[model samples]
Target chain A: MLRRKQFWFAIMAILPTFAIFGWVRLFPIIETLRLSMHEWNLLSKNKPFVGFQNFIELFSDNQFMDALTNTAVIAFGAMAVTIPMSMVLAAIIYHRTRSRFSGFYETAVFIPHVVSLVPAAMAWKWIFDAKLGPLNAIIMGLGGDALPWLFDPVLSVICIIFLVSWQTLGYGVLIYLVGFRNLPKSVFEAAQLDGANGFQSFLYMSVPLLKPITLYVSVVTLISGFNVYAQAYVLASDTQGAPGRQVRVLVLDMLENSFQNFRVGYAAAEAVILLSIVLLLTMIQFGLLRGKGGR
Target chain B: MSAKARARRTNFLLDVTLFVICILLLTPLILLIANGFKTPQEMLVWPPTLFPKDPTLENFHKVFTETPLLQWMLNSFLFALLSTVAIVATSALAGYIVGKFPFRAINIIFILFLATAIIPFEVYMIPLYFQVKALGLLNSVGGLLVGYLVMSFGIFLIRQNVIASIPDELLEAARIDGAGELWIFWYVVLPLLRGPLAALAVLAFFQAWTAFAWPIIVMTRKKSFTIEVGLANFQSAYTVDLSLLSAASAAVMVPSVLAFVLLRRNFVEGIAASGMKE
Candidate 1:
């Protein structure tokens, strides 16, 4: 009787969490998948099964094509910048672990990660402002032509990539620092005793050992990079006179389709694609983790 | 002169280089606060100044008076506070059972919680929005709080902490002494979990506080906007007054940054703990 009562207690205790998670997190993905296959503008009661018709239409959609290409570029681009840069920064901080300034350094790098995203992106926007911004001011002062950072087609995407990297860099560094701290110290000691310099040891030992960390950080960064909406929106959304060419990204595209154009079914299809990409990336992460453990 | 001296010299150089890089990294944030104090005329001046020529609180006053900045802040605070408390409670309750209970089905429950972390929010936000709408929760605090009330990461973190820290014998002892399970959890398990719970609370609060994408979609009205959404909207409304926009951004950033700096250890440890688990 006591055992049965304990079991029931556990079930009752966990049921609320299970309910909330299922309703909010799990149910939505299933519903989104289901919604992607039907045509409804979020208003009409008459819904028709489109059966991959929306996906077919999205393949030839020019705006989605641009959004896809830009999003892929930005995702890969941000990952490219963040991974190596943060690893190196973490290596430096790890080596200086005994320094009194280590805490200060970590906090300084991490402040950006915690700051509200819109404000941080706005700060970047002001810096990258075409005519009146400080970036142009510096360039012109240094005898280089003032490039339109946000206005130009290619430059604008690069601007978004930079913003993504700037925000994610702090997080990447923090994770890598943790990775460094967890690394076995004897390998470094062995390398040093064999007369390896700091750079050599870091290049060979730290790099290979932290391969899992690098993969984890890159996947996380790329996932967030794929979800890049607010940075791109705040940077280049349509303004009155001097609007930069709006960088069509995946999330922004979905929002426009769903909310603005009332193409709920079509946006749901786009979301399904985004979901597939994220799910694939997550699978890779899990596969690697399991593989590492099995070995 | 000596090997140790040479190594010390190299270390010194590295520290200086790292310091310079840190400053470079912090410059944009510094500019965010610095530019907020500039007068409008100074803001529009050719070859814009980094620091304000004549700093004033005029722009901050304008942000408060001209916009619904207080309402936005209040909304963000309530959203963060309420969601953080709910997530902590639910995660702790679930994590305690999943971590400590030896039921045959416990593994499945734990795995189900872990699985939710894999799906990104954007993929399902459409359906979530629809669900909220179906429940008639659109443009309300309940709508905003609905999606954030249960965090998969929080559940995982608390479970990990419980398993690693709280030995089952203590709970068993309490049980043998005729204490109810919930009573033991409240008195014994919770005190042991104070560290991770604090860490989870800090993380959850930050996530709720700085949340932009979902909140922006849910709260469309100007009066219900979170600080992030409000700050984004400030750009269009105060386009001509750059100082006012900067002031708004700075104000929104202050609380999170201050909390982070004050609780720096818990914040960093919480993040590190999450990353390390993955």
Candidate 2:
């Protein structure tokens, strides 16, 4: 009786979490997979199975291809810029500061991260505003033409990438700063004894030592890159990636299809593809990290 | 120059450079606040000044008097607080059971929870919306709350904390003293979980507070809008009112930043811990 009662209590404790997860996460995932193979306008009574027809159409669709390419570019682009920038900043802060004031710098950089993306997007929008924004204001004042920051497709993609990098830079810096602080002091002393200079020490010692952290940060940055929606949405002003759909990422594309175009089945198919990409990237990262650990 | 003097000069240069970088990082945020105080005519100048020539509180006053800003703030607060409380309660109970109790099925349950972390919101956005609609929670705070309640990371965080910090021997001693499992958890394990719980609360609050996309979808009614959704809507409606927009954005961002300031250490440590573990 005692053992049975304890077992029942444990089950009860786990049930709420299980129920929520089952209803919200697991069921949606399964339904998305099932819906991916069918055609439904979300208004009809029937969702007829199309048997990979949606997948075949998605592969051939030009917009889906553009979204996929844009997502890859932003994901890899943001990580490429953010990781190095954060490493350098983290190195400077770690090496330079000797007082409690270092906390102020960390907090300052991190303020943008905690702030909502909508306001941050709006702030960036203001900065990049054609006539009134500071960037173009400076350009025009210097006897140059005012550039189209968000009007040009390429420039708009760059702007979106810049916004993401700015928001996430602080997070990367904090993580790398922790990595720097936890490094053994003896390793630096040994490098000095071997007559290695600062740049050489950083190149040879610090970079290699921080590889795991770099990988971790890259994985997170990559996943967030694939999940980019609100920044693009706000920056593009909800025109379904204005200026010829140059900045349309997967999520934005999926959302536009489901809500605007009402292509529920096709959008569900897109969602499945995105999920696979995220899962594959994550698995590859884990495999690489584990492989490194094995040696 | 002496070596020590050269080193001191180098350190000074480094500090100046870092300070300059910090100022550069802070320029956009400062501009946001500065523009909020400027008059409409002043905002249209050739080269925008970093400082408003005539600083006034009229824009903030207008935002308060004109829009439903306070209602949105109230909605945001209620959602964040309710979600944070629910997450803490659920995570603590589930984490304790899975971490402390030696149940045979614990690993499978724990894995099931962690699996949700791998899937981003985009993957299930459509179906989840349908589910919310089916449950008749569309445009309701209850819908939003239900969506946020299953934080996989929070459960995992608390579980790791409990297993690592709270020893099994402690629970065993409580049991030997004629305490029930509920009492042991309530009086013993719960107290030891204060640190992780606080960290989880801050994380949960930020997630709920800054949430954008789903809130935009589910809260279709204007009266049910959260601060983020409200700000987005406001921006779309009044594109030219830079002052009012800036004031509203500042109003929305201050609370989360303030919460972060008060709990800065926990926030940093929690992020660092999670980052390193992965």
Candidate 3:
């Protein structure tokens, strides 16, 4: 009798939430799935669902291929650099410092992780601007010729990478710091008494021990790299992959189709494809982390 | 040197090096603030000044006068505040529901929520836009508010906090007290969930405030524009006004920074929590 009543109450609470979830998130996902089969603009009144044509077109689109390649390279690059750097930062911050300044340094570094993306991108844009930009200024000051940051095909991607990560190192450092803080200090002390030196103590004890957090950080970093947008939009003003379509990433493709082109069906197809890639890669990363980490 | 003295000296060196690196990390923000006060002409010099040489409020005045900054700030605050409130309220109750219930389906549902966070908002951008449009919510504040609420990350973030803090014994005991699940949640669970609730709320508020992409699609009108869109006005096909842009840039960041600093502990903890968890 009591069980039934409690379940009823729980259902009551979850009901409005369910409607909200259905109406807002879940319905749109289903709608997108349906719309991906059609080839109609949102502005059109009479729409015919041409099943799988949009996806087929996306498969053939060379621009889609370019966006995929750029996204892959950038996401993979971020993971490769940030993962090891974060581990090193965590190991060093744990074993290296004992001063009151560590706290101040941590706080200072963490501020960027919280700064709004608009200013962050704008600041990076100024720093990297080709003419009259500080980047050129620094290069010229060093008695070297200036290389274009946002204009060149190669350096533009680098600029995207740099802008996204200006403070993400702080993100990695801070989180790994917490996971480090939560470690039982006695483990390191135990390692020390066993004739373990500095690098050995970190490698033999700390690195092996911080497995859960390391996996967490890598997963987050990979996902965050995929979420890179505000920089490209704000700095480049959706003009990335400029100087010959070199930097148009997946999100940029989606935004261009949906916003600029207003081809809602075609855009939905790109989005669905992106969601699959992200989901698959994320799972693979986690599965590999589990397999190697001895978790 | 003595062994203790050598350790102290080494630690001091590391701190100095770390401080230098920290300064490098913050170089962008320092540049923004530094250039914000410069006259537009001074800003275009060969090498940017470390400090504004001819400090002027002209750009700041231009930013304040020409841009819809004050309104944008208010809109961002309200949007963020509502998001925080909705997240705290919904996630607290929902987290309790998942925590207290022993149903096998709950974990799957929780996992479903968590898994959604991994999917980028880019995936949902197109369809969700027209969804809002169908509800007749384009160019409206209510549209932005609801759009922010359906966020996977906020619920996912709050759920992690809830799952971490709520113990099984506490929930079971409330059940044994002839208290309803809602009763236990209202009186017992919410108080304990305050730390992470506060954490998620602060983060959600910032996320809502710094929201650039969603506002672009939703708020199409000039009067309805948020701080981010207003800041984007500095650039166009013809000219890039660097100084006024910096001032406008400063305007966009200040509210968010102030909000984070006011809730600094929770902000850091929330970020740490998110990174540590998933």
Each candidate's fnat, in order? Answer: 0.77, 0.69, 0.61
- Lowest lDDT sum, 10 consecutive residues, model 3 chain A, at A237-246
Residues B14-53 of candidate 3 have per-residue lDDT tens digits of 6777778778878888889778898878877877676798
Candidate 1, residue B241: lDDT: 74
Candidate 2: tens digits of C-alpha lDDT, residues B1-278: 99789878887877788888888887888788888898878888878877899999999999999898999999988999999998898899998888876678866888888877889987987898999999999988999886787788888888889989998788778777889988888999999999989888888888899898789889988899999898887865665687788888887777778878889988887788778665
True contacts kept of 2: 0.69
- By summed lDDT, the worst window of 10 consecutive residues in model 2 chain B runs over B234-243
Tell me how far the alpha carbon of residue A139 in candidate 3 is from the true structure, in angstroms, after superposition. Answer: 1.4
Local accuracy of candidate 2 as per-residue lDDT tens digits, A1-295:
7667777888887888788778888898899999999998889899999999999999999999989988888889999999999998899899865855687888888888888998888788889987688999888879899988987777878888999999899999999998999889899999889999777988898998888899889989999999898887788663222334337889878878898888899999999999998899889888988988922
Model 3, span A1-295: residue lDDT tens? 8767767776677656556766767777777788788877767796688888898889889988878777677766776777677677656666554766766676667778788888888888888877767888888999999987877767777777776666577788887888778878898788778878777877777777777677777767767777666776666653232323337787878777776777878988988887787787778767877787544
CAPRI band of model 1?
medium
**Alpha carbon deviation, residue B194, candidate 3 (Å):** 1.5
Cα-based lDDT at residue A244, candidate 2: 47
Q: Each prediction's DockQ?
A: 0.73, 0.65, 0.58
Q: Which stretches of candidate 3 lie over 4 Å from their true place?
A: A237-246, B104-108, B150-181, B237-239
Instruction: Give the number of the best model, judged by DockQ.
Output: 1
Residue pairs in collision within model 2 = none
Residue B190 CA displacement from its true place in model 2, Å: 0.9
